[model samples]
Target: MKVCLVGSSGGHLTHLYMLKPFWQDKDRFWVTFDKEDARSILKNEDVYNCYFPTNRNIKNLIKNTALAFKVLKHEKPDVIISSGAAVAVPFFYIGKIFGAKTIYIEVFDRIDKPTLTGKLVYPITDKFIVQWEEMKKVYPKAINLGSIF
Candidate 1:
């Protein structure tokens, strides 16, 4: 199976990395934003960088959309998994439209409060995973997968 492991920089990527073993036997690719930390993590993997806008305002949504299309066209992954802050929105949306199974893994920090991405992607996600069991309170259907790191 072809997989596109997509996420923003920092903790989001770290969480996804913990699930690396699952992709060890599959055809996988990494799609992440360009950040100094992201550069370090992607060093030994097949990776594609996407323009991750610093601003989350409405003005930059169009550019984010374009970047999403670019990555979707090039990768053509059968499944797209993301630990998101902002960039995952476009990736998940475009991946779904392209007939890819979209999986959303909520960030680890959301033990007490619901994150923006979690709320937005939960209902639409083909698979919704949470690191904390308490998250099930916020998203009743979320699967508790424990800590990734």
Candidate 2:
């Protein structure tokens, strides 16, 4: 199955990369920011660079949504998975519209507090995974996948 993995550069990307063993067997590509970490880690991977200043950046999110539409249209991934910041919003929405299964992994940092991205994507997500078991209190249906660190 073709998979599209989306995440922000920092810890979000780190956790997603840690799952390389899981996705490597599938046809996969990445959607992330063009940062030093992403540039280095994704050097040999199929990647689509998104705009920076994400999360609360309405302008960039809108831009990234358009980019997401284009990418999902062309890639036609069977599944779209994200360890998010803000870029995941557009991709999740567009991917859903295109009938791609959506999967979301909440970042490792938040145990007590819920991420805005997580709340937004949870309802549409086919699989919602959390690193902390405590997160199940916040996301009752989330799967406890343990730490990716």
Among all candidates shown, the one with the greatest TM-score:
2
Candidate 1 ranges with C-alpha deviation above 4 Å: none
Candidate 1, 1-149: lDDT as tens digits: 89988877888888778887898788898877788888897888888776656346565557767877887888789998988877777778888898999889888878967888777777778999888988889888888988877
Cα lDDT tens digits for candidate 2, 1-112:
9999999998889988988898989999999999999999999999999998896999999999999999999999999989898999999999999999999999888997
Task: Provide the lDDT at 3 for model 1.
Answer: 92
Clashing residue pairs, backbone N/CA/C < 3 A, model 2? none
Write down the worst ten-residue block by lDDT for model 2.
Answer: 105-114
lDDT of 1 at 56: 62
In terms of TM-score, how similar is model 2 to the real structure?
A: 0.97
Clash total of candidate 2? 0
